[model samples]
Target: MLANLLLEIGGSMSTLGAGIGAGLAVIGAGVGISGVGGRAMEAMARQPEIFGKLQTAMIIAAALVEGAALFAIVVCLLIAGNA
Candidate 1:
């Protein structure tokens, strides 16, 4: 009985770990996007004439980061599923 309980607890802990990892990954992505936004804002403020180009570039960069983050999340989900 004790062994079975321990097994179940260990499995649950691993699942929790996977979820936490995914959450942290998302948080990191959010921080990265925020940084991009901040820099874009600064650039636009400094050179109002280039607002259009800066905005476009910033958005593309954010999208790429988000895509990578999503890939990590998918991997985490797969791990959780296996656990």
Candidate 2:
């Protein structure tokens, strides 16, 4: 009984930890993008003439952050499945 309990705990820990990591990773990306978007909007409002350049830069930055987040999620999924 003790051995079984330990095994269950160990197995659960891996998947649970991976899930937490994956969630946090995505959350961080979302927060980063939100901030970027907010700043871009503010800048656009302040300088209507520069709106196009500012928007382009903001989108590229957001995409890079989001891509990293997606990669982390994929890694977490693999880890959970293996666990």
Model 2 earns a TM-score of 0.89
- Clash statistics: count for each candidate: 0, 0
Q: Across residues 18-52, which tens digit of lDDT does each residue of candidate 2 receive?
A: 99989999999999999999999899888999987
Cα deviation in Å at residue 72, candidate 1? 1.3
- State the lDDT of candidate 1 residue by residue for 11-42, as single tens digits: 89889998998999999999999999998888
The regions of model 2 sitting more than 4 angstroms off are none
lDDT of each candidate versus the true structure: 0.93, 0.93
Shift in Å, residue 65, candidate 1: 1.0
> What TM-score does each of the candidates earn?
0.90, 0.89
